[model samples]
Target chain A: MTVTRSKAASIRAARRDRWAQRLVQCGLHAGLMAWGALAVYPLVWVLLTSLKYTRELYADPFGLPKHWKWSNYQEAWVYAKMGTYFLNSVLLTVGSLILVLFLASTAAFALARFEFRLKGLVWGYILFGFLIPHSILLVPLAIFTRQIGLYNRLGGLALVYAAVGIPWNVFFLRAFMETIPKELEEAAIMDGAGMWSVFWRVILPLSQPALATMATFHILSAWSEYILALVLTGTTVSRTLPVGISLLEGHFTSNEPGVAAGMAITIVPVVLAFAFLQRYVIKGITAGALKG
Target chain B: MRRGRKRGTSWYGSPVGIFLFVFPAVGVYTALMLYPSLLSLYYSVLEWEGGPISAAPFVGLANFRQMLSDPIVPLALLNNGRRLFLDWAFMLPVALTLAFVLSRLRRGASVYRFLFYIPVILPATTMALLWRFILSGNDYGVLNSLLRMVGRGEWVRPWLSGDGYVQWSTSFPASWQHVGFYMVIFLAALVGIPEEYYEAASIDGASGWQQLLHVTLPNIRGVYVSCMILTLQGALGAFIYPLLMTKGGPMHLSETLISYSLYLLWQKKTWGYGSAVATLSFLLGIIAVALVWRFGRQRESALYR
Candidate 1:
């Protein structure tokens, strides 16, 4: 009878523990959900606001659009010249991605595999690039670009983007390449492959995922970059989306809904990229943290 | 193995191959970033108005001296310091706590992670614009409207326009955007901790909070330092948020050093003065990074010992 009483008391204690755990779990969920709502609500609010007529927006800032004005996107694209700006952004993004990939990968390949003089010094030099504030470089870069006759050119902006991105790119890619087995390169060399061939056939293939991650990151950064684009490009023909949207903001001061539409147009591609390639994006960013 | 050894020396290990592979990146990086940085040091002393380099008059140490005495410089630096402090005080703890909470959960963590990281994917400009609308000074603004809904309308003030509030208001969007970024960083650090440590703590009859205090915090010291450095650098170089949202308005109260420097260069056309500001910003950044590195190294060594 005493044993039975002890078991009953122990079971009651277990039940209490279970209840406490449940309560904690519910609290965690609540906190996370609230934060999640805060993270996403503004974008949703802006999107809905973009759909509403300007009058409706002022009248009911919090309300859903009475009529979905899909034409706002049209207006933003056609009339506001967001299309040209979008194209410019795409051009610069792709151009920089290509440059970064080619340069960083090849450089990383050599640094990862080869023995060379000043290797440590070179590594330090490149690593220091990560710390140098880009703002400090802005004045000189502007002057240098004009001196080189590349001022007001999207290509010049792309070149700058590529250069700024190279440090991190090489850092990440070199780390990734180090994980590739030395045996693979050795075997390729045994098959009479040159350094270029070995890198192309062995290293590049194995580094594709890392390459993709780096590419995604670079593209996102380049696409969203404003200050450099703002400083570099002077004309509508050369202005990227961020610059265009910023200019749009200035032009459409009173037209909140129209401006919001333009903002939405600027955001959609990035949001969609995040939606689809979230895994890569998260992996890329976290990889950066892990390395640090 | 023998053939591989010979072949490596013949082609793959040639110095020319290495040179060819590394040169393009080194050249471009030097031309665009390195050279320009060095040039800024040269330009900082010159009294030029964005003119040709040959025509500019060299005024050694004057620009730097002037910057040191400028009242606006101190204000900008103070604002940056305040922003950095707020980021560390609020952002670091919230992110760490949220990460810890997510790490403890058994399910749906990825969903929460994705949701939280949504703001991070948005451009800085978009974030600035969105917050501008939300924190708009007028009654039509979201925050003001909500204040009225809760019968606390009197508390509402011009967030981005008010002198007292503009700095905080401008800094908020950046903080909001990056909280998730640091959360992810902390989460990665937490996930990296060996499960055995937690198990051992549990076996010793330690509670959840005790385990975290003893096991988790000590293990992630390096990452914490890195996050701090990143936050400091970001705060120092803050430009987009102020540029897009407030334009460093209400008497330049919200302006960061970078924004002010840009204003000097682009708007005011004070090229030499702007270079001075940029140089100071760079110097301060270096100092901050060096301090963090020393601190982080010390902590790491102490922890190991």
Candidate 2:
């Protein structure tokens, strides 16, 4: 092959190409960084806005506040009744979490291990539960809870959250349990352990990682859940933070800062949870997507 | 003698143990989920007010007839269609591109990954609330304020007001919340594709865009299809956005089926009609999911192409 250009010229052209590639890379990364900033900007904006007074917020909605009005939090908590809503949300989330873990874990162990006549039917029951979209249940469940005397009660709401969680949790935990080696259960049984003892000591202990993953997963969902919480619960006393905040638009619409404070109260806990336990929550959600 | 494969040495295999182990989960699920969901069909055929459903007058298909005749019905359905279209059109390509770009970048992918997912983990109400203020009809709104700051104040307008804009305003908030989610999913799928695929593509003289078209997209088809199904569920069932941001609007222009059905029950107290809406909407969801499942599944492998 013959050289088409002088050596110095060819080298200079190669350097120009490399420089162009670097420029293109820079352009792409800059666009991506802008996208990331845009995505996160809302949460930061609302939180910052929450700390501004109404007049100050109106004056410069995009700028940092000259005087941080922490009273907005107090106003949202007390006047908007977000304090009660926060407590209700906490109670309901914790209550439902406990219910889901116990019921689902045991059921998962049985479905994973034992052979029974009704096992397929039982699994199909939970499986068929998926066939119906969740919104379909809002009507009857609202009425059924009332008829059965559990309506407007946080415990009842917890029970409903537990029920909604069962199908997925059982599916997830059962799959995880099936992957556990049979040797552990065999050793427990040979030690004269009954099914109860076996599950409590051997299987349950072994399933801690799955349980914790699911627990964090459940907290994230049940905490933020809105429609059902709105439907089932009655007044502000029974209302969760989300439903309460949704209604805050009606009552506190004029007080933008106060509303922002309510929004902050609603978001901060779950964001904090996601911050620390993201590994489990992200994996749980991704794995949870598999059933769909 | 061979031990029975169907039978076990454990007490869990026994009838009593099975009942004890399964009863709570089954009972709770049946009572709260299964029973109520299926009961909606029955409730759809009856008329109930504020009292117990037992005493409600049974109206055979009257609610269904009313729903078909309701004007809000068609509008709501159309809005849902718009949302579903936007979810697909906006989210899939954008998320795919973002995921692809992040995968190619030499630095800061980890921070971007975490930052991208923040909106997704927030409650739908929280997103709706943040966006509601951002798109407010006044100069104080974040969007308008930013616009004015940049001397584009003339471009600022109420995004969620009762009009065409009400439906579109939610598009960004919805996509913002989910783009990260689908990004992560695609990113995971991209990671699984062997590096040799790209190496071979580069050897074939494919540019980056060409590699994305020929190598990246084809590889992530399964994830993309599943993401389609997830997006379908999300779009069709979106409630909080409409419920908070627009409240189904000044003229009920932004109502989705789920939100409208909810408005019927909670506000109108037309239990039977609400049930009918919920039932039909859910049926639509099932049919949509099935259709996507059938159509999204690729019978021919992209590898051969």
Q: Which candidate ranks first by TM-score, i.e. highest?
A: 1
Please give the lDDT score for candidate 1.
0.87
For each candidate, what's the DockQ? Answer: 0.58, 0.46
Tens-digit lDDT track for model 2 on A83-160? 999999999999999999999999999999889897899998887766667788887887789989999999999999
lDDT of 1 by residue, B1-305 (tens): 13233455475667887888888999999999999898888888999786677998999999989987888888888778877987899898989989999999979999999899888878888778878888898867888988888999898999998887998888777877888889989998899899999999999999978997899998888899999999999999888888888888878888889989988988998888888888888888999999999989987898789
Q: What lDDT does candidate 2 reach at residue A231?
A: 84
The candidate that achieves the highest lDDT relative to the unseen native structure: 1
- On residues B126-232, what C-alpha lDDT tens digit does candidate 2 reach at each position? 78877877888866677878888899978877787848788878655776688888888877777767999999999999998899888887777777778888888
List ranges where model 2 is wrong by over 4 Å: A1-25, A250-253, A285-292, B1-10, B49-55, B203-206, B298-305
Candidate 2 displacement at residue B156 in angstroms: 3.4
lDDT string for model 1 (A1-292, tens) is 9999999999999999999999999999998999999899878987998898988987888889999998888888888899999999999999989998999999999999888998888888888898778888888887789889878898888889989998999999999999998898877766777777788878999999999899888877887898888888888989998888888866677788888888888888988887887788878868877776
Q: In model 2, which residue pairs have backbone atoms overlapping below 3 Å?
A: none
- DockQ of model 2 vs. true complex: 0.46
How far residue B39's Cα lies from its native spot in candidate 1, in Å, is 1.1
Candidate 1, DockQ to 2 decimals?
A: 0.58
Candidate 1: segments with Cα more than 4 A from true spot: A1-12, B1-9
RMSD after Cα superposition, model 1: 2.5
